[model samples]
Target: MPIIKLSVSERRRLQVFITCLLLAMAAWVLTTLSGAYHFTIKQVINFKNAPQRRAFKALQSDSVEVTMLGTGWQMLFSKVNTYNTPITVDLHTLEHSNYIALNTQIAQLNKTTDAKHRIVAFTPDTLYFDFTNRVVKKVKVEPVLDIKYQQQYEESGKIQVKPSYITINGPGNVIQNIKTWKTDTLRLTNVNDVVSTTLPLQPAKEGNISIYPKSVQLRIPVEEFTEKTLRIPVKLINNPHYYNVKVIPQYVSITFTVPLSRYTEVDEDFFEATADFSLWEQGYSVLPVNITRIPAYCRIVKTAPRNVDFLVRK
Candidate 1:
């Protein structure tokens, strides 16, 4: 076949048509990519929002660090923990900067996906921590003795106790500079029997940790006693009707032994000690005599020697 020669005008028209087709194809490819491809981002992560609940004790910050990681789309910006949650670091667990960096990286991975967002940035590759030894402090002693006793019983002796205070051990930062510890308010009324107990100690300031000894032992001495006396009542038996009865001695002396504390309650000496002779008639008779109505601790050892003679006449 023979080649045909093209004019300038025709060549220009063909070039314009081809250029337009190429432009349309490029636009179609771009649109397809925008709808089909899903990309992730990185964002900042807040260490504070990590914890869900309030930890009982204060945490150390020296060894802790925060880092955020996410899908390429998610890591685009910094991430914040919820408004109420607080993030804390354990000083004891912090050995080096790697500890802080490791924790931060873990926090980043916590996001929905492994991809890091574009807006997030991790800096200060490492963290520093400081530490010191823990210590114990002295606290005041509390007494828990009951002073109220039962009826007719009283405390008549002295009270004594051993070491009144104890020591507590805890973290140096928390224990240092503390002068003393004290127990809560205590009151005991109307206690008479032996009373002994221990009391718990509380820290004056927050964040102070203590362990080992929570309370101290307490001791109290008590006793019961009665008073002594020397007053005895008289008893009378056998009396004669026919003849006048003659007794050698009218009254007999008496004494008793009791606790000194109760000496005042037992001191009266007026009792009748007569023997009835109505049972026998016409002849002399003998009767037995005894003592009654004495204190709980008192005893009668002896009585004076005396005799009563009974006579009967027509």
Candidate 2:
């Protein structure tokens, strides 16, 4: 191929022509995007103002395809931004009718968005529901916890939840099967002090089930623990013969961990060490010292002289 160089004036004219073509394309894109257009998008449907006299379960899905009328820019952004605010429909009409007309709620739905974006129609114009007898139930609230305590620290007493129970109203079949509702998992790491906070309960899986007092107050007592050792006498059990049996070591040293608040309250009386003679009759020479009873909040560390020798006298 032969190399051909263009003149300065010809080069300048070519550049201007290319710039004008680019400007025209930009203007066309802006004009088209500014015009009004119609688009369909999926939206979640939420219910409010549920009827008090009857319980209902939706027969159709909780989502519907909504046709919206807006400018091209709004439609483009709506598709790019996938967050669509759920449309809430009032269920108060359900008391008199079994279905809800979505057309009647177009005005309310438009309020949830900007004035330029209008809800034109819904694919399923009407929502149907199945009615049932409503019932009330009282259920206990169970807390779920994932806690990591500092060294030598633990829960001191029982965890208390204010409003230990909550009221639930729903279909009889559904409410009867629910015995306890749990709160969202409360997580804490390296905890060194009492924990008092409010946690929301897990949301109901079935939309028709309603829980009152959505959140509860939690009071967890935490304390630093220290080891305490006490000598507790071992009591003999199942000694029906009434023979004088002498244990080599009559008392055993019991070591346990107790919270600082109740360290002084617990003593030898708070524990009971027992040795069953029935084991000796079953052909054993030694009796195992078992700490049968201990303070509920205390954890046993060790019991000295786990096994003791005994001498039988007629």
TM-score, one value per model: 0.29, 0.89
Off by over 4 Å in 1: 1-91, 94-133, 137-163, 170-179, 222-314
Q: Model 1, poorest ten-residue lDDT window?
A: 49-58
Mark the 10 consecutive residues where model 2 has the least summed lDDT.
Answer: 77-86
**Tens digits of lDDT, candidate 2, 75-159:** 8888865537788988889989999999998997788877778999998999999999999999999999999999999998899
Residue-by-residue lDDT tens digits, candidate 1, 80-118:
322112333333334332234434444434453333321
Q: Relative to the unseen true structure, what is the C-alpha lDDT of residue 19 in candidate 1, on a scale of 0 to 100?
A: 97
Residue 264 in candidate 2, Cα distance off native in Å: 2.7
lDDT, each prediction: 0.45, 0.92
Candidate 1 TM-score versus the reference: 0.29
Candidate of highest lDDT: 2
